[model samples]
Structures are given as structure tokens and as C-alpha cells.
Target: MAEHAEAEHEEEAEPRPKRAPIDWRRGREQAFSILASIVRWVGLIFAALLVLHVIFVIGSANSANGIVSFVRGWADGLSLGFKDLFTPSDAKLRVLVNYGIAAIFWLIVSGILARIIRRIGGVVSS
Candidate 1:
């Protein structure tokens, strides 16, 4: 019985798990490509929009008012939880508050998108 116990122990010790070697080069390449594509597309779209905005602004002074109206609606959502940025009130505070809220929201969105892209990169690499 003692010999049988020793044999079992020896067999268990001898059958170690064999791990496959990791290929770092291929993993790195996949990660790099995923991030590069995301950055390229995002930058191209942002640049195109900015250029169009600049052209519109230069074409006519009246277009400036349109830009202001656009911000007051879409960009104003961030301030819903906060106090009136503009009362008959402080015009400067209102502008600052609006911009501050927009900036915070933009940062949060950008961070989440970046993390998602990075995770996708890891998945593709694997």
C-alpha cells in the first residue's frame, strides 16, 4: 500500500502542464494596428469638420450666429444639473460655465472611447 501511494504521488508530480510559448511580436503588431486605425479615422473626421467650420465662418458673418445657436442647444445639456450660468445675470459666468461643462463631458466621453479601443486591440491581438 505504501508503494502504491508513492507511485501515485510520483505520477502526479511527473505530469506537469506544458504551456505554449507566447509570441510577443504578433501580439504587439495587432495592438499597434488597432490603435493606429482608430486614431487615423478620428483625427481625419475631426479635422474635416474643423476645416468646414472655418470655411463657413469665413464665408459670411451671419454664419457666426448659427454657430452660437448650435452651442446654446446641444452644448447646453451639460449645465442642466447646475445653476443658471446666465441670469439677467452674469454673462461671463454663463459663458464660462457652459464651456466648463462641455469640456468635462467631452473628456469623459473621450476616455471611455479610448479604453474601449484599447480593449479591442487586446482582443484582436490574442
Candidate 2:
């Protein structure tokens, strides 16, 4: 009985094998975090440009001013594909078409990219 008890004690004292470390998952998580931050910043920039464009259009910001011209140029360049899709018959309509569409487009694309990134991260971690 003492020998059996000693064997049992020895077994209990021995440590179990360690779990497989998740080194790859940690690396993937960090990379995904950095990517998400960059995407968010880009989205914010696009939204800002669209908002500034709307303000310029609605308030009739003077194109002669350097700041106004710069904002308009940036907005135009960023929203190149979505521009003039709808014929703006008036000033208010123009603002809606030129700025609203770009803002919505950026928001939707950003959201989709974020979701995709999250899904990929989850899959990699799992």
C-alpha cells in the first residue's frame, strides 16, 4: 500500500504537458489591429473631405480663397468616381449629390472592410 501511495504521489508531482502556444494568433491580432486603425483614419479623412465639400457648396465658400480651393480640390479628387452621377438641378441638390453620396460610400466601404478584417482575425485565432 505504501508503494502504491508513493507512485500516486510521484504522478501528482509531475507537471502535465503545456498547451500549444498561440504565437501566430497573437501576431495576427496585432497586425489586424494596426490595419483597422489605418482603415479608420482613411475613412475619417474621406468623411471630412466630403463634409468640407458640402459646407463649401452650401455656404458658397469663395473659390478664390486658398483653403476653400484646396478643400474643393481634395473633395473632388477623392470622390472622382461618384461625382456627377445625378444631375443637380439646384444648389441644395448639388450639395446632396456631390457630398452626400461620397460620405455614404466611404462609410459603407469602411464598414465592410472592418467587418471583413474582424472575420479574418477571428478565423485565424480560432
Each candidate structure's TM-score, on Cα atoms with residue i matched to residue i, is: 0.37, 0.74
lDDT, residue 60, model 2? 81
- Quote the RMSD, in angstroms, for model 1: 12.1
Best by lDDT: 2
- Cα RMSD, model 2: 7.9
Tens digits of per-residue lDDT, candidate 1, 5-60, equal 99999998896788999998677767766775676555444433333333443444
lDDT agreement of model 2 with the native: 0.82
The lowest-lDDT stretch of 10 consecutive residues in candidate 2 is 91-100
Candidate 2: stretches off by over 4 Å:
1-22
Pairs with steric clashes in candidate 2: none
